[model samples]
Target: MTTILVPYHQDERLLDDEIPVSADITVRSQVPDGDAWQRMAGVCSATAAAVSPVVAAGGIPVVLSGDCMVAGGTVAGVQRAGVNPAVVWFDAHGDVHTLQTSTSGYLGGLSLRLLNGAHPDRYADAIGLRPVPAERTVLVDARDLDPAEVEYLAVSATRRIPVSEVSADTVPSGPLVLHIDVDVIDSGEVPGLRFPVPNGPSTDAVLAACGRLFATDRVVAFDVACPWSRTDDEGQRNIRTQLLSRLAALAHPG
Candidate 1:
């Protein structure tokens, strides 16, 4: 059975408009307070508690919440269950910043870096999840990266498939954890993001790409980070619905 785990951020209200319609879904809210790092750890612990049983019985596909910080917790859950899953990170920015290098100091922006073993002080001992090696990680549709992040991407072995080159020959296969940051969609199409970039992939293109990738039967997890938008809530909800429907279609049949 595929278990969808929804870890809602405390500061962000749950988008209860479209969910709860699915009978197969199991929704668990994980609202955390206090420092960003601590809250992230709490979220991960909660996720592990919710998914351990399903994972122990063989393992199940998971659809996690949209806070990019939640990726750490998802990683912890998967790792604790003894699954060495490949990770496909779909985003505009690399999310590869350490505390020292990050200009914004936004914990969301640093989630990926924390997962990749960048900063020991900030995340190493706290998260209890080791970074998935660069070889096992593939980043797709990444264009708006910071300078230091670009440097890390250049040196690190993580395969990068730009939005333009997604059709290229180098895309990686699963057992994969597919992470989608909604900001990767152009601001015109997904105008609900806190940071809207001008040029990003179209919804159709992203779905098609994900469909092709998920057909590999290696995608055991899907995590989406679509931040709440004050302006276009309906539009963002529509996008999320479409994306989730596509993911459900691509998921392996029981």
Candidate 2:
């Protein structure tokens, strides 16, 4: 499998060497200040277009982005490639909201719900993305959620596995897109994150879960949301090394 590296800077200028390996494609945004929701929509659409060709050629996109919302575009790209891959969302936030449900009005927060086809969003429809069934979708380690988000999940069919229960077997079948929100790791253990939640899983635990998922040989795409790369990168380097090594392993046959 040919794996392409993509760094989604989300506007911050980070060099390739800052990460453990160089990226084949570097994605940066320069949208004028406007509606946050619209900006997010724009990113998803652009992400879909950028990776569509790679997906069509059967190359896996190893994307490093800033926010959980990027999954929408990742799903769109996979659809464009002729596969409706399931999404395994790993985030500290529920990310399953509607425009009405979100109190903070963070556009990316409702990414999962949006992808589930709850909207009349012109951009999503324009990108030709389909929704993943709740039964096929999994949201892992969302230790933090708003009241509305909690209420939505209570009645929703989406299967959720806490950090403690995440395992190779817990994830839905392969030909899957696995999204890892770096903030899902304990804030104390990790840094340079935009949002940090307490009492989350350890880095080792997250890596173990990822290992199990990758070992299944079912994962079709991977996303690591690293919104910011801080100057002090001792912690970041450790994470970068582990993730790159794991991705490299995925590319080569066992």
Candidate 3:
């Protein structure tokens, strides 16, 4: 059976409702404050530990909670099983900042750098997983980028595809880990995100892209980030719910 591991804490009510089948749901509510990187790391480490056994047994796809920073632990779990997974990072921001350059100092913003070998001591050494090769990483739907992140993208070998270019033809040549940051969706669609950006991909466009990606058969696991559903805007919540349902359907199509 497949498993959807919910590794979040702040807004449990958003995902408390029933999810689709084709998954054995596992919820880990160890949410850390946005300012606490160590706490976040600990939670992710624990979540990885809990899910590692099942992954070792094989044939299960783990859908972790929507926190981009937790990518470290997910990568650790995949690496422990001896898999080199390609990454499809879907988000508005590149998330390639180091702690030193980050204006917000949000751990989520620094996740991609950790995945791609920036802060070796905190991420690579602590997690016991090497950074994924730049060639194997793909950043999609990115628009709001930091200056440092932009410089990194210009030189890095990771494939960076703008939201406008994500079509059915995009394909990864190896095992894949798909990460979606809801902020990639336009603020009009999901206004609840802490960092909502303007002029992102439409909901249907993103879902279509995800559908094509899932059809590739190379995807081994999926992770989503920053899907806040409790904002004051009811329309945004509706959009979020619809998007989640679409993702669940893609993961469990019958």
Candidate 4:
């Protein structure tokens, strides 16, 4: 397995130390002359390029990025490798908001939605990412959701479930792209989360759920999104390091 590190929160590059030190490949954004959408396209394109060949060679790629939006690139890369994969998205908040519904207009909030055929002009189409169908995309542990997100999920074909319910029987059929945002763990357990949601699952529980999915051996890509503030404290950095190591271990367990 190759670890691809993209140390950026959207277009803004994160601190150098924000990513795990085990990176085999580091993606650098090459923004073209255009608007915000075009810049994001360039970033996602860079990530996709790093992810494709690894999957084609039958190796699972573990992508570590600063935010969930990079997931579009992971999916695109898998598709480029000729595998049509379902998506299992695990996060604290529902990443299903569109530009119209989002009050803060945060692009990260629309990550999953864009993967399910939203805003093709700016996102999916820009990077040549074929959107996964709603039924094939599952959102896990979205405990903190906006009213608009809730409404969309209620009517949308996408399946929503808790972290404890993630297993082979519940997930979409065929190959999968597992996208886990570290914030899914209880905010109290993970320090410096930029968008903390209290009263979530424990770190152990989250790992256990991930273990179940990895055991299936049908996961094509493991994408980890660390949407947290940079920490100077050694204790906090240690916690983050431990968590990332555990996550990487899941994809290559002996």
Candidate 5:
């Protein structure tokens, strides 16, 4: 397994960060001077370039990124390695919004939808990524959804499941790309979240769900998104560090 670190929040670089990882590769994207969407594409393309060879050589790529959108790059890299994979996306909010549907115009909100073949010109097409089918994608623990997202999921083929119930039997069949946004865990357990949702699953429950996925041995890539705000508080930083450490350990269990 190769641990890859990408220390940026969307297109912007994060400052005063303390993300704990003994990184095998740290992706530094040369974001061209452009609009927000174009810059984001630069980051994802850089990530794809970094992750492709690692997977081609038969090493599992564990990507640590600041936002969920980067998972597109991971998916592209896995495909470049010649394995078409189903996606298991775990997030606090439904990342199913498109440009027109999203009121805030946040690109991060459109992550999962883009992976399911929406807005190719903006994302998938930019990164040379082939969108994964909606039926082949599973979204877990999207307890905080917008009205637009709810309406979309009502008719979409994407399967939704609670974190506690996720396992090999429940996920889509074939190779898997497991993506977890840390905010999916209870906001109380993880401080400094930029968009915290209350009453979510505990850290232990989330880890157990991931363990079930890892136990299947079909997960080719693991994408973990750290979408939290910068915090100098020792307590907050410590909690963040411990949680990430535990999650990383799951991919390298002895």
Candidate 6:
């Protein structure tokens, strides 16, 4: 199948290189433009608009994003394509924070929680996105959640698994929108992240898991979020290089 690359490009003054692909869809904004929520309203709106038509036309979508909030747009696009979507969020933290609860005030930190509707509908409605019931979602490799996020997750219905268990057998069935934040892997292994967690899975382990998960034919679309700086040259240990290898594990896209 033809892969339509969706690059969520942003010049946050953090990246060390230009976006590698000529994006079929691009999400760009400056850091001072607005808060994280306002920024996502725009990013995901553009993402959904650009990606919805491509997905509806039977093309496979491969999202290369600057951060995890891209999940908002991916979910919206899959639904716009007339596909029922279950989500698999792979990250170092449980993107579950409310305006009242988050101390750091990082909006992207609320991605999965936002997807699950912890906040108002306005943010989601902006992109024509619907909330996925926590029951239909799985969160894997989130080893560094905040106190509020942890409390919410404790009561939430979303299934949580370790990075080691994120394989085909452990994931939910049916059409899926897979979200992989590169930080889900061990900080030591990847070495360059805006937010890195200790004791996360190895790149090799995650790749192996992704191989099986993708082979299931459940992934309709996927987003690979890279917070790793472009300048961090780690030879074979580069997050971008490792991400590309895992993305190739799928025999085909749904």
TM-score of each candidate structure, all chains considered together: 0.82, 0.82, 0.83, 0.98, 0.97, 0.85
Question: 87-174, model 1: which lDDT tens digit per residue?
Answer: 7788877888888888987767777777778775556456577778888778887788889989988998888886555532455544
Model 3: CA > 4 A from native = 7-35, 57-62, 167-171, 227-236
- lDDT tens digits by residue: candidate 6, 1-254: 43334444332423323224434445554334675456567777767766677679876577777777777787888898898788888888888888889899777777787788767564777667888889889999788978888898899999999867777767777888888887888888765577889887887787777766777877778777876655535563445664554564453434
Better of 1 and 3 by lDDT: 3
* Best-first order by TM-score: 4, 5, 6, 3, 1, 2
Show the colliding residue pairs in model 3: 66-224, 66-225
Best by TM-score: 4
Q: CA lDDT, every prediction? A: 0.66, 0.71, 0.69, 0.93, 0.90, 0.71
Model 1, position 186, has a per-residue lDDT of 73
Better of 1 and 2 by lDDT: 2
Tens-digit lDDT string for candidate 2 (1-254):
44443444432335555555556666544443556555566666677776778778877777766566677778888888888788888888888878788788666676788778877464467446787888778999888988988887888888888866766677666588888877778887766666778898887787677767777777767877765455555766786567556645654447
The stretch of ten residues in a row with the least summed lDDT in candidate 4 is 12-21
Worst 10 residues of 1 by lDDT: 17-26
Candidate 1 wrong stretches, greater than 4 Å: 1-7, 10-34, 163-174, 230-236, 252-254
lDDT of 3: 0.69
Q: CA shift at 93, candidate 1, in angstroms? A: 1.0
**lDDT digits (tens) for residues 111-199 of candidate 4:** 99999989999999999899999999999999999999999999999999998899999999899999999999999999999999999
How well does candidate 3 match the true structure in TM-score terms?
0.83
Report lDDT (Cα) of residue 239, candidate 5.
89
Please give the lDDT score at residue 112 for candidate 2. 80
Evaluated at residue 111, the lDDT of candidate 6 is 79
lDDT per residue (tens digit) for residues 130-225 in model 5: 999999999999999999999999999999999988999999999999999999999999998989999999999999999999999998899999
Which residue pairs of candidate 4 clash?
none
lDDT of 3 at 230: 43
List, in order, the clash count of every candidate structure: 1, 3, 2, 0, 0, 0
